[model samples]
Target: MILGHTIKDYKRENLLHDVITGIIIMAVSIPISMGYSQIAGLPAVYGLYGSVFPIILFALFSTSPQFIFGVDAAPAALVGSALLGMNIQSGSKEALAVVPVITFFVALWLLAFYLMHAGKLVNYISAPVMGGFITGICSTIILMQVPKLMGGTAGTGELLELLEHIEKTAEQINLPSLILGILSLVVLLAAKKIMPKFPMAVVMMAAGAVLTQVLPMKEWGIKTLDAVAPGLPKWSFPNLMLIPMDEVVTISLSVAVVIMAETLLAENNFAQKNGYRINDNQELLAFAVGNLVAALTGCCPINGSVSRTAMGEQYQGKTQLMSIVAGLSMILLLLFGTGFIGYLPVPVLTAIVISALLGATEFELAVKLWKVSRTECFIFWGAFIGVLLLGTINGVLIGIILSFAEMVIRSSKPASCFLGIQPGHKHFRDLAESRQIHEIEGVLIYRFSSNLFFANAGVLQQDIEQELERRGNIKAVILDASGIGSMDITAADRIEILYKSLKEQGIRFYITEHIADLNEQMRKLGIGYLIEEGCVRRTIYIALKDMGIKRPYPLEGGVDNEERSASRKRVDNRMQEFVWAFGSDTEDQIERQIAQQIKQLKQNGDVEKLLHGSWSHMEAFDEDEWLEHLEEHLKEIVNISGKDERTLAARFEEHRREIHERIMKEHPELAQRFKERRHRLDEHLKERRPEVYDLVVSLRELEKRKDME
Candidate 1:
């Protein structure tokens, strides 16, 4: 689908640039593919064969527009080891014949994986594990090339065996070859730093060819690639009768998995960087076709090459057209330019392979892993060490096992915190971080910061019990379930037990902010009926209100203490008039009249003055009946005054002076009584309920500002 889409949106303007980029990638791919063919235990010519048809096939079918599939070191080394274990000699006719059979099976496995839609299996390999695996492969590749770098035969086996072989052959090292390899390494590194955009690998290979032809280095014990077969690859089926089907299938499965993981990682990284999307299943199918084509042409298995993909990206590869051009260029080289490749020194190719592998090592990622998570750092080291001591496939397996164990450990001991209401805000924050925040008087707000599952059920219970013990006076508990994305049956059962236990202790238990999916989970698990009626709320505020507890505020408002007292006295005089006029027989009627007058005053746009005049009247009533009625009337006034507090406060202050003057002139005799009553009320508020006094003052100021607006 992506190939069809790319062709549909093809642009004539990008053709020249794409063609140039293709040629550049072609030049860079030639020598590297040759060296990797040796790594795959095949002749250098087969490497050229692997690159040509494989590149064309993948480019033609791939969903990722920029990715270039070709011979890569990891899968090559894996196939080489599998063949070597079977006692197949490297670079021999028998080994060459067997490679295509192995590759064809690998292709079949990839096709099977595509059919299964198994692309998401890559998610199981965490970043640290993948980094460690690549780092280990880089070390293995560099060590394997050490013998070639020193002008001797390449050694095999584990890292220590290879090191010992190099040491045993130290006396036979050729000086000219060593010098040429060192020079090549220097040139490659310098070019990378100074002119990274240029085709450094091609330039170095060409220079190596010229030097070998002009100098007497061959006489001094330097080896050259010699003559490469000059022709296009022939299509032929593998002699499957000669190979063990079961052994080939096992090796093919392993190689297929490694290729899938590495290729998907490279494809996803480049696609994200360039702002494109790739279908994973389509990528798997493309790899299947590429490897099948390579097998038909008698070449090793192929996968996406990170180095070549990055080179194509750096050179501004625009589309699959670049890949097509690259495939054709390889064909051109096979037709006429094979003679030039024959003169290139072996040491130079070794240097190119070593340099590319070195670049693939993620030392910075290792450092970051150490800094962020020590357990993940251990996983990286486990894989890295396993590869060095064992082999590539075994090392990755060890890393995967360790990563799963670490994940289980983390989930079993999830981080949790007690929440306290932050000052001046409704949010319940972790009290450990905000020490100034006060805990609610009889309520506990607890937050569990992980998914609820079997491994953590007991731990969750322990944590809740410990918190309840630490805070002895908590009568209502609100479990903030916002962090819990899902829950298992074990966790739901544990919660049900906790609910029953808290209910027996006379403490109300509630859950807040749980998602709909989690609610459905609880119901299916039979824990929903265990929770008390009205115990589930959408937010902390709603939960607190259901428990009959009001939120706390700081003892600060726009009105000063003296101004608030003056306003209270004016309201007290009005309440005294109502009390005297109604007497004891009509107390209920008097309360209704007062409420109606307050409502009327609010509608007449005099809310600020009315609220100021009513403040002391509300306080003068008895606490149970009269205060409840007054609070109901005040709530109505708050709704009428609008929800914005600042505007209300501003309007209240503007009308304050006028209300005080009018009250003083109309009731001079009652003024002294009002002042005394206000003094007593202020003392009572300051001594017993400072927060309530501040809240009442704030509400009046807010009402006043609304009236003025």
Candidate 2:
């Protein structure tokens, strides 16, 4: 972890506190590690040994400040699965010898992962999947031990088979073991509930010991673990010749993936909780060392333990000293306190494991998931089932795959809608749903609602091309990029191609305000400089103003009537085309609807009919009347959207004013004719309010220019 070497606030008093915290963590970890060893099908003493030197080494060299590195349930279960798979008898010398080799393999795998920088790969595992998987693992771990907790020996197999066996033989459950299991489970649960800072596992173990001595369960047919041999760890080297190369490599690969994931998770989580920043590479190295120690010291593969780290946090342990203390405590237990450990009941260990797994399920995360999406909740549950039924690896993989599939589906069908200005407001919105706005002529503005990435680059290019093709007269195309934040190389190349295509066609290509990083990248590609500098508008308002397009003012004289008339006509034309092309679910129905509106308008008095008519019902109308009403009541539509006509008018003027001024200046001799035309334009705008005219005119102008070329 990024626990900086700079000691900004170290104190002697805090050091003492760390020591006290370490001792408590050590005391708690000792019993747990010993118990975990039993879970691994190893002698309890090896668990105790595994917790010692490895913990000390990791504490000193590990990145996380407060992470308590030691033997964990995941690695233990993995080891047991490997041993069983290899047909190695649990207590055989060969089984014992294979562990070191496995540990060495796990360590190397971790080192490789670190070198490859695969830490961020976990981000692809969606939150829902993780929640489901962890919860499932917790439930599975609990269920798997139910038989043992009740004092019965059952061989592992498929989850369903094991569960079926337990259910079929419920009556065979030993009453003494059941009572012990229930008692230990209850104590551990209660300790966590009432005093979480206290070592609940240790307390439960002590309770188990007390119950064992006071009412010896063995006499009553309750099973107990045999006495474990206690000693300092002896170095063990793998006998390469004794093991087949294929078996060793296969087992190593499997164990490595499991251990690497487990340790990296623990190290990162611990560092995050303790305000330390973890270096993924450094963490892998530390785990590599930890694994090496576990191998040579006659123990199963070790990984980061979330439970032990939580214990450290609860007890205010925030230094490697905690790990040292915990390690030393285990050594002392081995050297002189071995007899005391024998008194601990097997049920108590099972209780501790179950309870810890329950805590690790991340209940709070599920609550948060509910707020994100119901689909995510479904994913979570699916992964949870996968973990429970299929095991951790398979379950996690399923979740990841499902999440990725969801992303691809969404991106493949990203949202695209016509950009319409609020009826009287400056802000643009989706034309289909909003009553307030109209699509502008000579300007095709669109916003793509997802990242421009390799997966969706083709879609983006097609969508843009289709929009431009539909409005072939567009003078400027502004891409509203607020929704987009990232782009892949393919997407960048596609954008460059579109830019050059637009430029060749004399249609200015512009990107509006976008993410800074994307803007820089586009600039680096020289698209920024190649395009018209003024055309690269930062916002919708700026783009419209720069283009000199303006909305007509009612009963106002300052505005140029002809220009407003032309603009209104263009807007009407686009609306008609949009409605014709992609607006309605059915073309025949839309045509019928339009016909009905025209018939109704002819039959009713203007104010009376419109005042009472529902907008959706009145959608069908003659183009002339529809355009006139749209322009006249544009303010009303905009007002409903909480904006006014002036804002929209100002934006429109920003785009069209320059061209208007230039035209007037260029033809001084026709000033009088222009003035008369402006009045005629005003009269026409109020009466016609044509939707398709402006779009048609813009397209005609482009066609005329192309003919000149």
Candidate 3:
């Protein structure tokens, strides 16, 4: 029952890797932590304090081994915004006193959430909403740092106010500070783009420290981190009397939600990448303890750092040992390195902070969502705008509300399409795609592409009724339940009403391709008897056959000789068009080449290996048309040999192996390149045709093993 039990099976080599990774992470965390602390309205050094004990606590108790908990921007920004709204000044005794109180209350809220089994609350907030909120936070953080970057005090308020403050302070900007800040920003951005693996923030900070020492920074009116206190942070408890209890509770609850959502996302992402799992409840407990410790130590609230976790993974960190190393390294910095850090220019740190925040903004995701689902795009923008105008807590609230609204609207208006048989295909397709599709003279096939729930049950009925009215001669209606994975009572009732109405009109109603559970639900709801006997069929083809409807052919096979002849004539016309479009000369060459290869296969008694090689060489011809012709020729061979379709299919598979082996032997270099190209194609296909891509990949892997043998 111990959390992060994977640590028990750790190897020495993994330990060594983790030790080095831990050290690297510590190097990165220190300056970033200080920057985040400034965002949290605390002295820059409090960032380091937050990173230390909270990280150790999280590492000890968290279920996720790879997740690096620290002073992340979102929570710190939220805390700072809330405090600023309450008129508390950043880096003041009042702000310092209030932060720990808020941190303590956040810890309590997390503990409450843990007890209530609220780990799944993160699921309620959709990806688009989270992306928009983070983007907004990034914008806010960047704007807040502009004044600091210009050698002025950090601004307070929302996006507009911050922008206004910057404009008002434009005349007071320090030239030297501005130049150094811009230079630091350039260095950080370039490092990120050109050498992502390098610790650009640390490098820039070091460079700034060296520059500050060599240059007369004080005389030039350039601000530097001159007051950094030496030695490690001492233990201190939250002074609850310093802030109103109601204000503390409200801010704590808001901060806790953001922390939980962000941390869980990071944990799940890393766990999935590493082929492991983390218990969500245990993660909550870990953060709760970590935050509690942060409160006790008078530090900012902590959350999982996605960037830091990625760094750990990049360095091959194996366990929580990396976090421990990071914490100890921060300790070393506090005890021995504060003197060097004190010489670091404030403008350089501001640039690091701005660059980091800007990087966190997800413009790409917003654009992608815009392309795929406009509603999700709206949700993202709404959340982002809310954060900018209304502040973090209210922005997130608005986003959550909008997300749920969008979900409801989508479910209430599901996509229902009338299906018709495509000209050269056996299965039914959406009627909208092709006007040439054949609709059965007295039948209608309808498909609803969503779960049949209470919200959309009436919509389903209306769509079916509309389709029935449009298809005037419909004697039978088949509901393609392949896409309807589940149904609620209201949907079931609506379906029953539709069936009764259709039956009254002398139209036969049938359901096909639904799971057994749906049928069971129907039976339990007293509508089972209506579909039990001949009313429900396993497939659309079976339903048509049972209704004595013969499939039209030349399209698929099995037809009367007269119909077959007409179909063949139509098929011949279509084939001529395809051949002409592809150039008849090229088609003829490909046909002759395949014929000659098959003939050679027959002579060598290896006919089973005929179609196994790369079809890329025959790219001059249309692949589908060529494959159809090849199949027909193969069928002729099967007829002459007295073999069945199943036997032919099995032989073709063997032939595929033979071709693969021959390619590896005679053209090994090309075969390797083909394999690599196929891998890239497989990755591309995953988004377009996941099932087909998976099957193809498995088959290719099997062929690869055969080639190896």
Candidate 4:
């Protein structure tokens, strides 16, 4: 559980990618580890030493598949500051003696954290906070490296120190170093588009080394890394004599906590981005082993290196094998390729590091938040700015606080709408977004779009009250409880108060369109009276019907904001029940069926057969109504088919006998129903539509004469 999870499904195709990624990581690690090493008050080579063993140990033990582990900024800076606080000189012999002991104690604290399951703390940090924290870290480190690209040493500390360092470096202006770094950055950045899988970071690094060898290094005064002494990292016990036990324990615990917090958050952030799972407890175990290796190698306390890990991910590293290969590659460099490190230009290396960090920054996340939710955007920037001004831990804290505040604000003022019944839709919709939707006469339907909790109960009540005031003659108020999944005591009590108030005003109050489970929830919350009093119904339609309100539920002043055409409204008026069922789509539905029926008529020369067989009219409860709907489209049907009205009438008369025969053959009940209740709608059709009425009457009379013969 603590290791080799990625290897269980190790992909063979990814071997070369991981190997090349390992080489690239080792190359990038040279400058970063050295920079952090100096910050931790150790010699540059110790950073390299720390990289080899700790990474290998992490690969063996870490549940994280691709997260690169080694010396990182937070723990290194903590160690360096601890040395300063204790009045010990940095990079001195006494400092060297004390640092490993500190690392050893840090490892012990991590072991304790593992036992306590402290890694679960990451579960509370939101995605926006994690993304912003990562972006801030990447930006800060990139700013630190910008000075090196302009011919100065890598800057330390926060945004202010980095800006100051860049300004100072700009003042001196090493022309050759600046040009080389910029060109290198251009190449690395350009490679991603031109050849994404080309391993350009390594190619640029090798080219930088070859440039230093071929070109004059001292003449141009280009900064390159110092030559590392060829030796393997020795397993040595820490000498604790240089610091008091109490001070060491205090400082080491602080270092360990920062390492654990910063690294675990970054690691889990990566895990989330890549769509994998991490066992938080086992991740702590990995941290313990990695730092123990750091202690044995006489290096600063180790943590997950976000900069290096981001670089590895950019190059498409897969599996823990990337970590093993990186460790092995570092070992090979220390033993045999140590002299080659002297020829690699700092400007070119810095450019590569800066470019990699640029890719890692979450600019897209910030922009998306800006577009969709302004409050979330504020939370993101809060974390990003906090990291630059303060540190990683404080940055995460600031974002979390902002997220909680936003949640509270949103819950207190959740979405609510006064709904109007659109003619064609079974469910009501928001009045603002609808056309030809009617608010029922003396009836108000309200919807609240979040769970009814203590914070948002007033919002629900307020929305209903405003609508009731606006329409003073309201007889019934319907709460569409579809959006209210459950309610708390405050909300339940608020509802009771609302019902009493509405009753006092002679308006009936009802709750409908919620799950049956919600009724049980209301009962448990002491609002069961709403249910017992027949105020809770299964649907808004039933609730209105029970209140003596019926179809086309007459609106306050006809259809409010009636956008339907006059001709279309006439069609709707003729088919009021159909419009009530199918809404605005009724005309289109009828026209399409008539179009389909004409095609069938052209082929079969049958009118009655087409009507009975049409799947579109299958939902009609009454055959008379279905025929009436068809008759409405019959004039267009005649014109589109190039048929005379008299000829179509003759066909209808002739098909009436075939309809009887077809019905007797297939279903006797349909024949009996047709005989019993035929021509029922024709009575109204004569008054409303004389042309259709006359045509239908002539057709039926012609059929009757033929039957008498």
* RMSD over all Cα atoms, model 2: 17.5
Summarize candidate 4's per-residue lDDT along 1-709 as a digit string, tens digits.
4344556777789999899898889888998898899899999999999889999898888888889998878888889988898887888998778889999999999999999999898887778888888999999888888888778888888888889888988999788999999999888889977887788888888888898888996588789998889989888888877678898889989888878877877888889889998888788888899998898779999988888888888889987888889899999999999999998899988988888888888989999999999899888899999999898778888988988888878888877778787764455678888656778788898887788888889888888898878888899999988888889999999999999998999999888877667877876788865654668766677677668775555766765343443233211112223333334554565556566777888877766565553432232222345556666667766766667878765665455556557556544545666565455656666766789878888787876897899
TM-score of 2: 0.66
Each prediction's TM-score against the native?
Answer: 0.72, 0.66, 0.66, 0.70
Question: In candidate 2, residue 83 scores what lDDT?
Answer: 81
Model 3 stretches astray by more than 4 angstroms? 1-45, 61-67, 72-101, 236-248, 265-280, 305-322, 370-373, 401-441, 523-709
Candidate with the larger lDDT of 1 and 2: 1
Best by TM-score: 1
For TM-score, candidate 2 versus 4, the one ahead is: 4
397: Cα error in model 2, Å? 1.8
For residues 177-291, could you state the per-residue lDDT of candidate 1 as single tens digits? 8888889988877877787666676677778878887898779888887578899989999998778889999999989998887688657656655798788888999999999
Stretch of 10 with least lDDT, candidate 3: 569-578
Off by over 4 Å in 1: 1-32, 35-42, 81-97, 155-157, 239-244, 269-277, 310-322, 422-425, 433-436, 531-535, 550-709
Every candidate's CA RMSD = 15.3, 17.5, 18.6, 16.7
Model 3: how far residue 514 lies from native, Å = 1.3
Decreasing TM-score order of the candidates: 1, 4, 3, 2
lDDT of each: 0.73, 0.63, 0.73, 0.80
Q: Write the per-residue lDDT of candidate 3 for residues 293-366, one digit (tens) a residue.
A: 99888898998886677667655677888888889888887888877766878888778667666666678988
Error of 3 at 120 (Å): 2.2
